[model samples]
Target: MSSHVKLRKERGTIAECETQVKEIRSQMAEQLKSLDLHVEMRVQLLQDLSEFFRRKAEIETEYSRGLEKLAERFSSRIRNSKEPQHSRKEQDLLSSVSCWHLILNHTRQESREHAVLSDTYSNSMVVRLCHITEDTGRLSKKSKDIGLQMQEQLLKVTSELQTAMKTYNQYHTDSMNAEGKLKEVEKLEERHMGKSADPGLGQSGVDAKQQRSSTLKKMERLKEKRQAKFLENKLKCTKARNDYLLNLAAANAAMNKYYLQDVCSLIECCDLGFHLSLGVTLRLYLSAQSRVQQSQQEAVGVLEGAVQGLDPPGDQKKILEMNHTAFCLPFRFEYQPHEGDQVCVVSAEAQVRNELVTRFQQLQSRLSSVSLETEEVNKTMKATLKALLDSFSFEDFSSSDSLQTSQSAESVKSSGSDPPGNKPNIAKRRANQQETESFYFTKVKEYLSGCSLISKLQAKHDLLKEAIEKAEGIDSDPSRLQCSNRSLRVRKQRPCSQYNHKLFTGDLQQFVESSGQLIPLVVESCIRFINLHGLHHEGIFRVPGSQSEVNEIRNAFERGEDPLTDLTDHNIDSVAGVLKLYFRGLEKPLFPQEKFQELVECVQIENKLERACHIKKVVGCFPQAVLIIMRFLFAFLNHLSQYSDENMMDSHNLAVCFGPTLVAVPLDQDAVSVQPRVNEVVKTIIMFHEKIFPGARELEGPLYEKCMTEEEEYW
Candidate 1:
């Protein structure tokens, strides 16, 4: 009975101990789980804090850079203005007005910092909660060491949280203070703006307004003075005009009084004589002639009386008495008649009459002196006449000229009848006939030559007309042509075609059309120029065509014929090659490859607006030839796209065919070296086509890929 009681009690005790151990283990596990959750939260909060710091630094740097850029832009605008000093002053005023902007920015920065700190503080609380969770596992294992370390870490975290909170509160206060200052600054700036808006009001006192008032007063005075001067000048001009009129009238009166005497005398003479009606100009002219004739008659009478003995005046006296008439010259002034004026006219006439009488007396004295000389001349003339009569011979005076001419001819012929002096008449006639025949033959030869030239010119004109018709027909056809075509292509192949078979037969027609139909003719002309100038050395630069054929083609071109249709494959290729040669001879390339690369880079800017601006800047610097070539390539690509749609050569095929050929590459450099450049240019050209014709399909093909890859490999 004693043993059973003991066993029962022991079992009860053991159950109690087991129950206690289970409760303790459950509590510790719960604590450990809570600790782990706190640790994870702390770690995440620390990471977030680090990220916030990084973002804050980035924002600050970006803000600073943006501020500097804005300032530079404003400064540049001010400096570039036409009024530098005035603009600078305005810039200063603007800066003063914008002072509030800086304050606002500072306030905003402070607010942001405060917000970030407040967030850090809030997150630090979660970290602090991690420390409150006890780590019982450390209490069990190395209890003192683990507990002390956990306490130290917890203290450190708590201290950092406290520091962050303090900083947050400080930033919050600063933000509020800055915001208050920003308001004050804005109020001050507003007042300054109002004051500046009024031109009459200035910070430099009222000096500017006062100066403007003084300048206005001076301008009013100056205007009044100018008006007065103008009036004085007008008065002077009026007085001078009146003086000129008076002088003109006086001069007219003087001219009529002195110079118009002939007119007055003519009027009087007409009235005094038989008054015949006549035109004024005719009467004046006839009156002057009559006066001159009267003077001439008086002088002639005196001379006749002095030179020869006079016959008695019988029938002439009677005829003169029958036609006797008298005329008088009236003296009159243009204005009021002056007594002295008439006296001057009467005295002048009287002087003339007295002079005439004195001249006649002198003539009579001279005639008496010359009378002896006249008698001597008459006696000599009579003796000469007698000698002439004694020496005259009147025999055979009635004979005809023909009879005399025949007699003279016979005498000359008989005189030349000697062997040395007289050759056979037949031989002389033969020589004359030979000379005449040779001259006529020479003239005939010249006429035949001229006729041949005219015929050749006419044939050329006919050929040119035929060529025009042929070219028109070819142009009318829509089908593309090839060297192998039987009807359209030339049948006769030249030696040059065999040697340059690839070039001659290549598809160069697309690029050649834009240059002109005369490109081949120009090339031939250049080749001729080269040969004539000795620019072509043997085997160095030989043009590939028979000389005669080239000359004929060139002549036809000079005659304004379109010879494009007449050009064979061989000639076309030769001309295309020459075209390239001409480009190579230029001092600078048409499109510099280096500059094109820069242009591509410019257009490749990421920003669309910036890219457009850069494109304008770059394109503006391009040479004229480059611009033209770019336009041509753009057109070529558009046409090529159409050609592709029509099942002709596609974009890639055309690019491959003509891209490198269009741009002149130096022979010293391999074609492979510039193949990529040409391909890029071709792609750019296609892009331009897309821009011009937006509805067109984009370029695509395996051939394009192949070409691009080939070019890329070269690079």
Candidate 2:
């Protein structure tokens, strides 16, 4: 079956054939030696005869197997003569029928056997001689035919050559006549030198050509350099983008882990059950509601920052109108409220956030520096502060070892098994250690009683430090060297707002770009988490990207076997890749379907902790404080301001990319939100998606309107 083996077989057969050819030729020669004839003609006839014989053998060989099969099948019938017959008459049938069949089969078998043998051996010799003879004959016939064709072609060529020769001769004669005229003209020209016109025309043409050539070369060089610089800039941008993405991913991963842990701890702490009343429960709920709304407001603020940063042109009056139209689609759901139900929730929510925000501002103003550091700090403290505030009883400051001993004593008293008349023994035992124990308790009580006075002094010192710092930063003296020093806020300044301004023209665009940059990194992190946790779409932390959202339009085109024409083409079924996944702690409702709920929890945790610790929305992000209390307090506040959940979809009826990064969450019909984060998410996603796959927003008018409305409300 292998090629090498088959090739070897073919080669061996050819060699055997050549050997047989020599033997056949020798045998034919001996037979021909007896007849006298022309050596070449006799040789040709022998070859022809052999060739005919070989061809007959080849024909038989082609049918050899079929003949053998037929022979084998009929041989048994011929031998037995007892197989089924068509005729009714069985007697007097000649036995020679069997003999005749046998003879026929023998002849067929002989024919096939001879063919195989001759084709395998004799045929080669016969074929070779016949081929040689035929070749010679064909050569002779061809030579004669070629001689006739050549004569005709030669005559045609001779005629053409004669015509050409005559033309050349005539042309040469004319050229000689022209030369004589030229010689006469030359002599005339020499005699009349100043008679010629158009002198230096050729030179001028040469100069013009040279100038054009030089200009082309300069243009080519300039174009090449421009193209090269463009390519270099593109490379630099790509690399910068990659670096930014990597850093963003790392920072985000660390932040999210810490955020989740803090949220879980804080949630558990806040959920701690104790003695409660209806008023207290209501108060907690109201506090929680306000905290949630403030989060929504701040999230909107962040989104607004992002939108303003993208540097959108301010002449967007028409754009704004269109955006509004897009957002103002008719309500489609059957349970559409009479506006009261929705308004009730909105109004209560909004009022709470506003009130809470105002209170926080008031509280901040009351900070005389000490209270800023310590929420429980007394504003008008004196040396008696220790007696009034910092003082604690010995029992309140009891050591764990002492408390354990007291508990043990109570347990023993309950047992009531002490011997009678042992009062003297017990008194003697206690009398020795009473002085030492009393001394210890007294020292601790004195320290606790003296603490408030020290604190008051410390508070006063902190107040002075803050005043000095604030005064140093302020430019109250207009005449001072104002020319040199710059203010914190400036035109095109550094430490760019991490939170994108969603309204200042470019904020939404900036949010989109910033989040767009985040997407790839987020996707990679998602993949990494999925792998590390062995997670599917089951619970907390699912895969975040959606291939369908990314390539829905392309998918249609691919199905149709046509090229996708545009990104935001009406046929686009998807607007983004994965935007929803699990936050680490809240494991229920994992995928996009449960995104709204998870978002609520993430934002809720972010909110409660902020309210409990007096963290406000104005400075909701992280604080510079290194203390654990401050770190956690402001950390939760930072999360709350993200509007991670509070301001997201209320209807829960749309596709949302629910992750820490995406601004591309597209809110759908009946989609409600305490805040309209999805609108911004969609805007950001579309903008960024387009940067890679250009012209995505071939139909972005509606999106702009929806996003603007949501952003406006938040702002």
In terms of TM-score, how similar is model 1 to the real structure? Answer: 0.18
Model 1: per-residue Cα lDDT over 543-626, one tens digit each: 233455555544444444434333333243243344344444334444555565564465345564555455555554655334
TM-score of each: 0.18, 0.13
**Model 2, span 1-715: residue lDDT tens:** 5545644654554344345434433433432231112235535665665656567556645565556566667656555776566541353265766566667656554434433333332433343344334433433333233223322332333233333323333333343344455455545444344322323358887776666556556655655555555555434333332222222232233223222332222222121111111122223222322332455766556654543443213222322343343212222112111111231111112323344334333433443333333322221122222222111111111011111112222332222222233333334323422332233223332332223222323332333333333434553422122235532211221112234322111222333355332212222222322222222121121112346543442343223221222111321112212213212112221123324433333333334343222212211232211111122222222322233242222212122223333222234522323334433332222222222121213222111111111012110
- State, as a TM-score between 0 and 1, how close model 2 is to the true structure: 0.13
In candidate 1, the residue pairs with backbone N, CA or C atoms under 3 Å apart (3 or more residues apart, or in different chains) clash, namely none
Q: Highest lDDT: which candidate?
A: 1
Each prediction's Cα lDDT score?
0.36, 0.31
